[model samples]
Target: MEKLQVLDITGLSFTSLPLSIELLENLKSLCLDQCRLEDVTIIGKLKGLQFLSFLDSTIARLPKEIGGLTELRFLDLTGCTELKVIEPGMLGNLVNLEELYMENSFDQWEAEDKVPRSNASLAELKNMKNLSTLSIAIPHSVNLLRDLPFGKLNMHKIQIGEVWDCLCMHKESRTLELKLDSSYLLLEEWVQKCLQRAQDLHLGGLQDGNDSIHDLCIEDAEAEDGDEIDDDPKVKSCKLRRLTLRNLPMITSFYKRADYPVDLFDAQQLVFLVTSIIMNSVGYSPFAVNEATSLEAITIERCQLIRKVFDLEGLTTNEEVEILSRLRELTLSDLSSLEYIWNKNPQRASCFQNLRTLKVQNCENLRFLFSSSMAKALKQIKEIEIVSCDKMEEIINVQEEELEEAKSADTLNFPILTFLSLEELPNLRTFSYEKYDIHYPSLTRLTISSCPKMMTFSSSERKQQLMRADIGLQQAFGHINSGLSLPVFFNEKVLFPRLEELKLSSMCRLKRIWHNQLPEESFCKLTSFTVELCENLSHVFPSNSMDRLQSLNKIEVVGCPSLEALFEWVCLSSEKRQTPLVLSALKKIKLWNLPRLRDVLKSDRKVNFKSPCLMEVDVRCCHSLPYLFSSATARSLRKLAILEVSVAITYGA
Candidate 1:
């Protein structure tokens, strides 16, 4: 036991460390996490211990003897809920301590006697000047802040309870984070003092009052005029690089009032500002930053009363205001009342030119992501994701006037867009209401699911173009014209030209994958296609287009009960049938829970399975299929490495 260099008694039921533990003089690390440890006097005897952890334990008090561990460098007491008091001078002896974590550890400190004693114990932390990281709850007493060596210590990272309590922080400290409760009040003097020094500042639970940031600045300026000029150096501008405000229910706007000076955004060097659960006040916009050019990212979540993120009406100047030009990422989530990301302004569209990624989720009131005019200016956007928005009808909403103008134009293009995912939007009708030859040349992946009302993937104008192209459609099987009125794929236009993967699910009204004949160059790069729970879908691909899908390797169809066949071969004469449909790259096919499926192909025309890499065929619960392939096509399945057929009534017959 004396030779043991590491001791781990974690998750044990022991209430106290064994006295024999003191014999391990060479022990350098000790872990008692998730144990019933109420006493740790034996730990102090391990003079060589450098690391000590008591996470999630029931220990009520730390032994005063803990100061004797002079070699201790890392101490973690996180989640020790019962721990309330620490003896004075306990931490003063840990001169070599580099990191200390005590988050949610002391719950009884709110009582009278425990508060002062705990403050004194915390004051001892100043003696350990080597502490680079510290996380602790600051007491409400003013003397505790004055007595603590915050201005002298060189802590690079610190997390405290209240900002006002730690007003005396070291100006040289690089980072400070405050996690205040809802009841805590934010003083302007303390906030301005901290912002002048902290490089990265995070504030939470800042209650609203007349003492807003603008009011604070006004008071500070008045005081500066009354005082004599001194030689003491101070940060002239807001030096904070990152500012995060969370759970601030009282703050409605970035500024208290619209008439306030714009210097709040101009003077700050902030690169990122993230706010969550911060309600927008009745008459103010959530993002009122008009001159924040240095901001690179802005994320707002669960902010109420935010009808639109940017309020252009509040701006004094109409002259092409360049706001958030350097921003690379923007995210908005769970804002129930959010109607638009940015107010529909043609001039302000240029602000999003540098944005690379945009994500919006659970914004139920948002009818559209962006207007058509704004979409045109988002040339740098590489990825767009929208999910669980119940009211979202379109991604790029085109007004009636814009639709008329688009019809006269050549094309609507998303030049650099590579990834698009739309999910759980039940009322979505189309990507656009009136499409004018929409093109996505760089798009590689596409996903659409749970959009039951989405019958067609094309715009109303594009559908009319297909209907005008004279594509003959003689109603044949099942319900004839009773299916959805729109086609699953676009008619004459080639959407997602570079698309590599496609997923479609729960689209109850889908009838055909494509309405009209696609150009030979269409879907040339598509490698995978999946369709599931689309009960109204009858066929996977149109008749003669299989020859164009040379890159298709995998196909999956599951729970599509009305699907009668995989391909609908048009009235191809016997002479044309001689030119076999060859899928050169096809490797895998999965058909599951499709009760009405009869054959893989509806016609007797031969399909030449020329893919040497073809390996799998999985068919289960498809009771009506006599065979997956026709007699001639079945010969090709003999070379497959995996041919799984279960509960399929007559698969081999």
Candidate 2:
């Protein structure tokens, strides 16, 4: 017991410490996390106590007598919301404290001008010369010391004015979450010093004298001109890792300073950022966004006035900078006024080569996400989820004849794409309408739901984009049809070789998922297939690639009133060379509500359906289904264990 170096008493309630508790004179660390206590100056008896923690505790006060523990090197009072007082001279006495955490704790700090001190104050921190880490929240800054040299702390998380949820990390470097009154937004020396070194900053509740909240000087972390920030945005070498702007209801623009060449957030060091848009500035932007290499993620949500995220239009710059080269994630949600993700001009010098995940939701006004030129650079993208954007007609907007001319042989490939979800897009027509051969070689999971108007995968032939403008003009002058019509989705090519699951629902106008006959290697590995509410779809697979469904393990078709047959080429093939229709690995099939489904497989002769592994079949509400399969095909389902037929079945279909 005498050699005890650590003692932790967690989740207990007590009024005072027992006399025997003080016997551990060699205890260097004492943790009373989440405890309740009123009075116990007995902690002072442990002269060897170097580390003390009252994390999330209900200790109302810190007895001044315990300040005699000058050997204390660390003290934590984080989340001690009930703690209101630290007796005067208590903290000043602990000169050896290397790390002190008092976040969300006592804030009734006695001002330096008080006649008689009743509780501890900021002046107490002056003697903590060895303190290198400080995490504190000060809701009341009126009595703060104007000369507090917080720059001396090697690592600090300081919240000065208003308080928010403390989710931002400290990164073992400086972090500041400031939301002070209008007067305090000025670059006070100490505040400026904090800004200069802050790796993560969360600024909210800022208002100028006229309540305009237009303070671009904060972006210039290196500026020395007190309040004279010039119109030309300064290009400061910033090291900010994350920035969050909240509740600023006036600044409307994002990344553009309208008529000026302002490079405000061109820090080239921002890792993650949150922006705010508000009230009424018909059009605004984060003017002149210079390319940054350190930004990893960006989330812009609920910005009512934002129309565009990245607008590089009319930029005539000669220098090239890769756009957010390290950014891995980008999310935009609930921006009602959002019309474009990227404007007419894709930054010719930029690329999204490293962005892996993109999620967009509830932005009703957005028409398209990426142009063909913007999409060509997304080689590392893996996951994309876009939902409820009413005006979204396509994922990629095909450029006019001129821009599409030279992009014929280009392959817009998502090499590592694994998952894609597009839901509730009422007006969505297709993924793309033109010029390039889109590839999803590694796609595994795909879900498309409620896209009622979507009928084609891609309509444009790459050769069309290659046609010369002179030829196009001549063709137009002659009024001759080059024989171009809206083609069906999923053309004749090898795509999605690694696809595992495909689910489609509520596509009322979808007559075909694919029309052209694809190669045998395409969709060869698809395991599970599901389609529902697609009333116009007649068949599932193309005839040429039907034999490649050896890997399909499950199928569920429901509510497809026009589905006459489940598989293509259901009639028996006469040639001996023809490959027999085989679902060798199929395990389950569910057919329901298909009023017009005539048969699953119809074989007139020996080329019958052979599903040696088919186990379960469920058929219901198919009043018009003539038969499930031919007698030869039915006999091949030897492993079928469970068969469910509804009362509406004719002769137990």
Candidate 3:
């Protein structure tokens, strides 16, 4: 047994090491992974022991007798969660040790003069000339020196703080992280060098008292008399990709300037930042954001008290627009205190030209997402989704500071926007306020649900109350005087030229879907339309504008009790003839639970447009109907197949 060279035991249940097993005097490697041990001092007599590991063990203390193993080359105590103390002078006695690991374990390092004379001091590490690899946790930094020379090690992961993000463990070769309060004594020159050497580093709680990290950088920048950080930069913050701030309640933004207290990167880019407190803003940093050209996407979720994402207050230069220009997608969710996605100054323009998609949900305090100028910069925006934001009244808002200025630039155009969905926003009134004309020239699909307060898509020059649609949104036009806002969903100023699908539901105050005859370009390509639980709608389309739906393919309406007909003909004072409603491209139609519906079509004129493509028809519970369709319209239903109804299949055309 004295001649044993190696002994490895993994996941073995044991109370203590066999005292007789100490006979292995020449053991060069001894690994007891996941083995519980009460006393390991019995093996201390093995002076030639070169490697020892008690990985994931429950050992409480490493005895001073461990010093007897002076020839030890490696020691691993990783995952020894209960190990709080190591006898003073024991680690220093390992003069030949080459590697040491104590991470997630012993962190109770005592100062040289502390009463825990039983506990080891970090000073012992100063003399280990052969030590190249190290992993340690010093949860309390009061006992550590500001200059530990950790940068000299080839590979190291040093965590110093009370709490750490465990999800970041074991993912990097060299890392330095801390959740401790800002202490200058712990961030001295050697620590700065260590930060420069880290690969996946995190500097948490970098704030000082009431001051934020941006304040720190601004102060440092001012100290240099507004000069850029020193020219002789090898690496200031390149390797450190992540920064975390915890419990910093007063911070307004992150890294608004390039200058900071420490030298961190040579390649100027920050990948992601995670904060655990009330953050007032995001993307206020110009230097870091401008250098991160490859940053494509950002997702922030489960955060608390974030007021805005971008605060473009004093920024006017094209250089500042580099912040979010390269980002193609941005998603924010579960942020209860989020107020604005982009807080902008309309006079100063920044670019979001490459941002193609944006999604937000569960942000109850968010009232609006973009300012007018911000929307103008979204030239390539293709998709937007907002859900469950109770206070959101507008997707593009005209800030009070820029209201008068916005009037000069009257139109806000989304040139390539294709898909937009606004769901469960009960307080929403309009996409833009009552002034500027918002135009979606390329909009293809639109979905709005539970937005009972939406008076119109845009209220520019056309504002109407729910019951005032018959009195015209504006003064009477021409000889017809056909109240322009009779239907209140859309106005003339806002256009959906290529809209293919529109889904709406649960809109309690909606009495109409569209106003009087819109231009030929509005809703001209609509293919599918769906509505559910809208109690006040009397009809789907007004008879005068029915010819504009030449490309509609499918229609589904359900649970609207006050709905009277699919098409309702309202004659203007000069109109003596009714125009027939034609869904020429419609292939499928489903209607359900509309109790007051008397007819699918109410026009008295003979039908001129034939729906040669009608494939399926479904109707149910419409108690006041007479016949399915007029005899002339039924003759063209050659492709009709699936027909299901709760009441008789009867509807007057």
Candidate 4:
């Protein structure tokens, strides 16, 4: 190999060349960035080096013989902010050139006339058909592109959007973008539409009102009727898939009916659309109709509007409005006045039946979401989440007799529900089962947090006594016990056979999970469990029976101050081998904030068969846990963590 090429080297401390670096001749890229070299003018001797990246002011201006390398492809002069005025025809001989990247730091201070004219000859660029990409930071502001001397050039991608607007003039360019600030106005009629293949379109910082300077808004375009005029110079759909309208505080509305306007319903190929109308307090904007049949996802944010969204009048009945049949996801948020969204739910066959997931947040005035008849029609929904809505107290409410009859009928509905969450609602008191009752045996995740009074079974003893008197004593206890039983009864077998995750938080009076009966396979597939802040809960599980919980892989007990004696009771249990309390599948255990008496993993005498599968233990803020794993028999345990506890234990070998 010939000596490796070095295009340009400067600002380094080296006084002489390293003799070993002279063998690799084909090197085409080089940069000596911000080093401390002095008097390095031997660069012309490297004949094979092509690309050169040199600082402008730190290194002197290039020698007139700098065009010796005929194979130059790229040159970067970014850090030399003060360098200006290139000599005419400085790069005319570079016939194999492809790109030139320059960062013009002098643009802020230089006048438009004082900046150097293009020293490189025009014949070089026009003759090179292989040239694809060009990036330049112009030293002085000018209308750079309107009168460009080059003919039409074709390329697949061009990104020129972020350059300051005063640097480029308005022109019907290729696939390029023009970015303007909130106060900068480009004449709407002079707007140049570009690129027959342009697929993505974005407009930023365009403001509204007459005196504000931004007169070229979509709303300002001349309109005839509500329909957009087809003769206007608008991009009639190419291959566009994604369109985003964000942070435009301009005159309201997306499409001007008279000029540059077309219907999305007319575009039959549209798929995904995201729009934010935060400042638009407009009276109406009909975004989609039956023409947009291929739309799959739509998100509407901060559009504080009048109550109703879609009206079922002369167009189509609620049953006929199949506007988004292929739509799989929809999100609605921050519409404070949108209380009753679905008014035509009573007349429709089913709305949002194909919806798989729905998230509603911060909609305070949303009192009713789809009449009860509509929610019952959704069979394909798998997840529903509601959070931080102060006014949406009760989503589903039905009579108690209806719930009993539905349970007696043994329905196999709720075929797809696997996750449900209700959180941060302070006004919610009762969650009636009948209106929301669907058999979700496939549910693997359920979280209920921060709702204070979600009492499915009444906690009042006087009310229980009165109900018992009305029903007579014998049937009341039976009903109360059956009503409070958990693990869900399905034809006398447990329903949650696949459930692996359960969390309960902030429930102060929920003293028990099940009052009397137990499932034949309680927690049969339960792998992770967490229960917190149940201050009235005196026991973790039902008093004497834990026969069905053989599949527990991990358990976390936290924030219950009254249940501190639980571990001591477990340690003092009957040591008979036949009736031993064995958690064989349990591998991880954590206990936190239980401040009372506790002794865990203790053995007064040497044990034969230990708690075989307990491998890890974490104890935090438990003041009473004096010793853990004190037994000489350590079987499967490999790690233990303890925090804020005044206890120490010696595990014997």
Candidate 5:
């Protein structure tokens, strides 16, 4: 029988089947995901079989005859919980194999006899001369295969990086991968010597057995009591740049004298740094953090110990400052213990000269984030992202009232900030700066999400910041849509000059987008606006202020069910003067998932869009929408797509 080209038997619940799979001589692809099976014995007879997958299936063992399928190229067996072993000599004949995936539980095995039995099990795979890619879960560590005969074959194009029972491969090889849960603790001296040849190195995975971080730290403390150790040799032979360590629990401190000392010398040319769960607790002063002059990006996660290391001031010198100053991208996540960063006195803080991107997430314990002095340190930063930080009482904590009273005193603040993103925060109510001026001339994009408790910016509720324009209360508050009205007791509002994109999503309690405060001049450069999931917003951008929004290009409203109208009022005097002038710049309009929007254009609807400039209009999933740009406006509409929407356009003859 010819092999099957494609066999998709997904979601099949079969416990046993005939071992006749080898009869499919021309099979090119086979998928039995989620099937319940025990063994794959019939697969060996399929001489032309190429691809096979049993992901999420229950299979325990493979027949030794599996090696007979020389034409097989890809094989996957991820999530096969019953798979206990790979039969010995089942893979040596698969010379044409290119990719192999095995998601097995090899880390839980403990018996010493179980180790060799597993080794003897894989004796056939070493003969696959043409194998290019291999992804598998080792029973313990990669060191177990160090003595295997794989030395004869040179791997190319692909490399295996995982957290297994293997010591760091100090070897200089290509195509590298290093996982975070490996067998680094069981590594002997000989294994380390052999790994010194790998070129691309991956440093990841926590140590197993006595490798528990708490235990390792205690052991190191006891051993270091002996004497003053000097001349800690370096591993300079390994030229590694790409490093990834995930879930490294013992990283409370980076170095130790008896175990592993500070290793900045290895991989000095690193360009990327990523780590997860780095809890640095080893309390040693002047910690050995190498200077990565070539470092461009660094990501830190849940590293509680970082607070002490970066606690700068007169304590560190220029060389240390220069190291962090060169970084461009920095992402900090889940560092819950971080209070105040940088020096208490702003003048001594390290400056990030090339740093453009800064992302901070889930730092719940972070209090006053930026001091006026520290804000001056990040002058080069353009993009800033803060999310899920519940304890952020204030950004620049100094009282604004006190600062204005002393404005004559020269104070430096963040003036270069351009892009800002705030999301998933509950307690962040204000971002007021009093002692220092916070201005962003280059500001363009602002994205705010899931901030329920946030009311507004500034303290005095009465004084507005630079807002100078006339806009309708209903329109500005259209972002708040239906039920509740945004209270605008203050006369002035905030101003954004160069902003092009503004996104507000899921503000459930928001009754209005802005207070009915007036501005000096309209936001001239405002172009694109997006409002989503704000159910209460009823009307926005009154027709009178339509001319002031001359640069408005596009507006999108999605999932705002409570909004029944787009615009409520229009000034007749202003309309007659314009002489039916088109909203010449408006390009696109999209309205989706708004169940309350029953009409697009009504006789009383004074809304006018520049249809000549409008290229596309998409109205989808709005079941009640009727009419096409009030018979007065549809003349210039070029393209229209209506999905799951009902439209009624009545032409009055």
Candidate 6:
């Protein structure tokens, strides 16, 4: 034990440490995090300990003997919820301590008799001149802040709760986060007086009744030298790069021109912003006209009253027209009252020119993703995902007037889009309500599930393009009738031209995979196709479609009770029948729980299976098939490995 330099007993179930740990005189690092230990007085006996952690443990108090560990440089007690006090002079002796973390480490510090009168003040931290990082909760009392060495210490990071006064005055702190238990009226005063060069600021649990964020600002007070504080009392506007606001329920509005002379959004250097559970803020559009030019990312979640995201009504300058041009990512989730991302605005000029990813989830009131004008401007968007939004009727909502105008306009293009996913949107009817032509030049992946009412990809008879070069749209769109009516075209266009993998599940109303005749090169580059729980689907592919699926490696169909045939041959002519359809790259086929399936292929025309790479055929719970494959086709499956079927079927070879 004397030779031990490091010992990690993390996540162990033991309740206490053995006294033998004291014999480890050479131990330099010890971790008992997430353990069941409650008392650790024996830890003090290791004079050579330099690092110690008891994170997420039940330890309640530190023994006075712990002060003897002068060599301790790092100590962590994060998530020690039962901790209430520290013995007097316990921290004063650890003069070499460099980092201390006590975040959420103690609760009920105000309860009667919860902490001993002799308990040491956090002022003991003042003696640890070398401490550079600290995360601890401060009591509500102002006395704790007076004796603390705020001006003398060079702290690089600070995460504190129950902020009183003067704590923000530490100019050397690079990051400061405040988690308030209650509203503090002097918040603006502290920000104006101190926090001049902080790079990151996080404010949580700030609730001043019925007052918006605009009202939080206070005029700069005159300094003791009789000189008025600088005109802009905010943290040096160019220094703060990231800001977060969480659980500020009473903040009715994020910004108001009449309430403040200067706004926090005016910080020109800000890059990342996050707001969660800040219920009453109406929208973030205010920032667009003010200071959103440098922002790279933003996240807003669970903010119930925010009905819109971007409002550009107040923008008047040409520079404001280019706001959010550099933003690359945006995420909105669990916002029940969010009705629109950008409300109808004929004058809106800002564009998401650099946005690459967008995600929206569980926003039930949002009837659509964005207006037609906004969709046309997302030139750089590469991925879009929408999930569980019940009221979404279409991804891009176009007005009746706009729909008329779109008929005479050229096609709108998503030049770089590669991935699109829509799941559980029960009311989704189309990708766009207007008949505007749209092209996805780079799209390679698409997923759609649980959307029973989705009848088509678009309501208008417009040209659609999926430009995957390996298997271009020319292969699939050749058979599509531009004049075909609503729901059928929806099912027909389900498969993109360049799609290599496809999955369709729980589409209750889906009747056909493709309604028109099969093109000569249809699904030529497809590798895998999967269909599950699609109750109304009767057949997967048209008769001649399988002939061009040269790259198809696997097909799986399950829980589709109404599926009757895998392929239904539409014999075009005797000339076409003379040359049997071939699947040269086919390898595996699995069909399960499809009771009505009568035949794998229901064609009188000859079908050829020339795949030397063909390996397995498994058919289970399908009661009506008399034979798995036709005689001529079975003879050509040279590489067949396993044929598992529910009923004995005649095999020609």
Worst 10 residues of 5 by lDDT: 268-277
Clashing residue pairs in candidate 3 (N, C-alpha, C atoms within 3 angstroms):
236-264, 236-265, 236-266, 237-264, 237-265, 238-265, 627-651, 628-651
User: Where does model 4 exceed 4 Å of error?
Assistant: 1-387, 394-433, 439-448, 453-497, 513-523, 542-548, 562-578, 596-611, 620-653
Q: Write the per-residue lDDT of candidate 1 for residues 499-545, one digit (tens) a residue.
A: 88989998876787775566556677899999999878888988777
Worst 10 residues of 3 by lDDT: 216-225
lDDT of 5 by residue, 193-288 (tens): 223222333444554422222111122211121322122232122212323334444454433233434222122111121111111223112222
For 605-628, candidate 2 gives per-residue lDDT tens digits of 445567889899999998877666
Q: TM-score-based ranking, best first?
A: 2, 1, 6, 3, 5, 4
Give one digit per residue, the lDDT tens place, for model 4 in 1-653: 45445545556645544654434467665666654433333444444666767544354344434465567776555555544434334455555666654443222222224446434433334444445434344322233334232222322223333443322232212223334443332432223222222233333344343222222223333432232322323322222222222233332343223332222211111123211110122211233223333334444345443343433222223233443344555555665555644533324333556767766777777654444444565567788787767766455433233345444333334467778787876555433222233355677787777764443321222233433343443343332123332221122222455568877777553445543353444446777777787554445654333345567778787886655444222223344523555556777777777665254433343333334667667677776655555454354344333223333222231
**Candidate 1 wrongly placed segments (more than 4 Å):** 1-85, 92-179, 188-251, 261-297, 313-322, 345-349, 400-407, 460-488, 515-522, 573-575, 604-612, 647-653
Candidate no. 3 TM-score = 0.60
The C-alpha TM-scores of every prediction are 0.70, 0.78, 0.60, 0.51, 0.53, 0.69
Write the residue-wise lDDT of candidate 3 on 546-590 in tens digits: 667888989999998878888776543324434434577899989
- For model 6, how many clashes? 3
Model 1, clash count? 1
Total residue pair clashes for candidate 3: 8
lDDT ranking of the models: 2, 3, 1, 6, 5, 4
Score each candidate by Cα lDDT: 0.64, 0.70, 0.68, 0.45, 0.51, 0.63
Ten-residue segment with the worst summed lDDT in candidate 2?
A: 274-283
Q: Whose TM-score is greatest here? A: 2
Evaluated with lDDT, which candidate comes out highest? 2
Range of the 10 consecutive residues with the lowest summed lDDT in candidate 4: 270-279
Error of 1 at 443 (Å): 2.6
Residue range 243-351, candidate 6, lDDT tens digits: 4445554443554443333222322111132221111123333433244244455555555556656643343432334545667777777777767776443344556
Per-residue error at 639 for model 4, in Å?
9.0
